[model samples]
Target: MIGRIRGMFILGLCSASALAAGTGYQPPFHPDQLKGPPAGRPNEVLVLGSPHLSGMPDTFAPAQLEPLLERLAAWKPEAIAVEAVSGLQCDYMRRNPARYADSVSSYCVDTGPAQAATGLDVPAANAEAERLLAQWPATPSAAQRRRLAAVWLAAGERNSAVVQWLRLPAEQRIAADGMTDALVAFLDKRLQRRDESVLVAATLAARLGLERVWAVDDHTADSPTPKEVEKAAADAITKAWDNPYSKARAAADIPLYANVAQPDGLLAIYRAYNAPESAMQTYRSDFGAALVEPSPQAFGRNYVGYWETRNLRMVANIRDVVGQTPGMRLLAIVGASHKPYYEAYLNLMHDVQLVDAEDVLR
Candidate 1:
């Protein structure tokens, strides 16, 4: 367990003299004084709060994320998780293309052309892709790289496609899957969203010489609400966000946005938001507001319930991905709103050590 807090547990016995000496003073307490569940295998987790790059304003530039990516690559996590539906691209799309076709078509590379180009269906292409990746040598030939790119493209893994393209010789890489020129160019132009979790996670994984990225987001907890209830909930949430406290928080983010072009500047903002106090703020502004609503309909409470359930399921998914591997460090890239919830739920897991994102970001 690399990041586990190793120390002897010692009880701090209260002394009568110390109590008698001071009226309002308390004896010092240590973390080891508290009793907790039995220690298990330690899995270090760092949850990175990220803005959805796809929806960035017109002023945002892809170049802004380069230094940040470089800093993250230095951390060298064994596993990476992004805010995406697990199996949506490689597994679900292959098995139920009709169901996920529209989504994949809209957000990622079109599977139809890729399948046609590779001469294999999505599932078959994914299977072959796994085999190729498993059997890939330290120095794969140009032909093998091309095949890897084709297979990843067929599986709707555009980021992996870009990775394999970067591995290929200049002559071997082509405009296949609309990947213009080379990987960097394609990411800068075709993707147009450098801050995307899949793009950032996959690229970092590749840079760290890892095989795959994990998707741990779950939406099944979303509750179906009647039109009237949904409207009320939305209105309540909107009102909460419009309050002076929320407005001040939003205003404070302006500096962070302005510094997105610099790694150190961005890291400062990240470290600040990743603090435990920031989590408390989120809990108060989000969950507390929901609980305080006076309506008997419990409209706000329903939304809060859905949110908590979603985070719980997401944490479960992360555990499943980590499996029984001890001392494994996992980096999770998620929306800012989900960061606190993820940290809270992960800390409760017996085998997990929720590492502060600030430590790594620094």
Candidate 2:
């Protein structure tokens, strides 16, 4: 579904925006907002955390992703690192061939192959990556194809032999049909859980020609009942939307479906829907209960805490990594809630450039 041609078109529009901004009209932010990375740093890192777009049709759309991708490309980062595991990066590269090689790094906060290295322990990223790779055809280059084979091989002599065999020409390597079919089956199972975040991340990585994309998340051993948690969270979110206050706010704001005009309008909606303190306590209560029931709130103390920690960690991780890579600019396409947090975090970093979501959204 993700094609190179479509990615190029998106990149072109982003180029135009970068050129237009040359005339420089600076905006002001509160002191609190002005906290995080230092000012004027050449290396730009964008951390975006989006909500599940499929479920929140009124809040987000897939088309909006194009601009975000273009903007990040315009920044011309040395590499575009994503919140995806290395396995997914390999699969995406194999399926979607590009002209140039770009470097991408993923921080795994889960228990996976890279757990000992990053100590992040995020396996979902790896699982998702494997699924994506299986869905796509192997790349044309024999060397590249061999590299992929190496990843799948276990740590032993037999694995090394398989890697050597794959290095041979098309005729030499074992029939790829069997491996290809098995990969497809693996992808089918992975796609069953429709998490839009991985899709958005993968789509952006493929479009940007990023060499590698990193997956960041902590792995959990226990299989928490995600379905029950999701149901509870959904119920809470729906209730808040239907509440009297929420309805009043929605009514006060004209053109319910129109793009939010002022940042305040967007913020007001976010607060009503997800603020830490509000009349509709059921949303928070259910969210907390769901967290506790599943995994003792390891992800967050409450829903708000979860959102805050994830957003802050992303900002922190970007700052930590982008500084090391000279020209790498990151654009994170995250949820609306993360926008406010990023706006505040980036302002604190002295050298880092802050692009307002409102400016881009408009």
Candidate 3:
């Protein structure tokens, strides 16, 4: 599944700060304060992939990324690669931070720095790029020139179209830019017409196969404490099972919960009973209780175990790809949830070099 890039420019703008913050930002733990990865392993390239935090409407907000970006930047990576394909667009955003905001706001409803300049919705770094681009008349500004140079370096001049354009005479270059803009517009139109879910799923499949994309389970997979188990059981029986208002209580195991009369009826009751606020409160309460055990050993064991399994699988996939085409870079686009674990595991591998997300944003 080849994924069509949508809002590539917007994503470039949105992720600049988050990516920059991830690189060069200091962390709570000093380098000497922590132990390094195990000895005797080939170095591997690893990058923590994350969605555009700012553009999403509700599930995850951009503001929540502040600390996360800071932590990631402090780790310092060799390079950062984003999902963006257009070097020109990224350059524009980086130069004109304000214009980046306008462009983003124009594309995404209720988002971008134009809405709120500070806090979580702070303008993207690409806005700076655009601003810089605006300053140059018929010629690229110093920053724009640097960006073009960086793009050329990253993409390589051997067979790159951008490099080809650079080789053209100055007068011909204007024509090349117009052609690039036309191609971008054509692609953007195609993307805008696609189903968003399908686009997202296809993107993931192209980057990481189904087997490589595992559902992250942050909660404890083991059985709860005796007291907690008893409480859950009691709750299941009383609040969920025996309540007169509960219609689906008896049909909880039915496969057709959404279709069956009893089960479907009970689902409606549950939905009505559990308002968003109420559900949030209940979830918080349960989460608080679960954290009381304070078992770092258990937590670390579970965490490391999952990561080890994932890393082995990823290594196998990387090996297969390398066997077919040596020296090819494998880009993985994954949710933010998997970033930390993947980053840590990849750091331990000798065959891989993690790309700094900051470098990509810049």
Best by TM-score: 1
User: What is the alpha-carbon lDDT for the whole of candidate 3?
Assistant: 0.32
All-Cα superposition RMSD per candidate: 11.4, 16.4, 21.7
TM-score of each: 0.73, 0.44, 0.27
Q: What TM-score does candidate 3 reach?
A: 0.27
Q: Candidate 3 at 180: error in angstroms?
A: 35
lDDT per residue, candidate 2, 165-229, as tens digits?
Answer: 32345453432422343332333333333343334454444455442344332111111224435
Q: Evaluate all candidate structures by whole-model CA lDDT and list the values in order.
A: 0.62, 0.39, 0.32
**What is the per-residue lDDT of model 1 for residues 224-332, given as tens digits with 9 covering 90 to 100?**
2444455555666555445555666678788877766664565566666776677767666666665555454554455555667768888888988776466688998
Model 1, position 6: C-alpha lDDT score: 10
| Model 1 alpha-carbon drift over 4 Å, by segment | 1-42, 55-59, 89-110, 119-122, 169-171, 175-190, 222-229
Shift of residue 313 alpha carbon in model 1, Å? 2.5
- Candidate 3 structure quality by residue, lDDT tens digits, 1-362: 00111111221222212224336856685442343353543233434444332333333322333343334334432222233223233333445554344333332222122212212121332344335335645543433443432223232111122222333344543312213343323323433322211133222332231211111211111122244234333333232223322333225423323432442332232233222333333323332232222332232222233334544444344444433433434444344334444555555444455555544332
Flag the better candidate by TM-score, 1 or 3.
Answer: 1
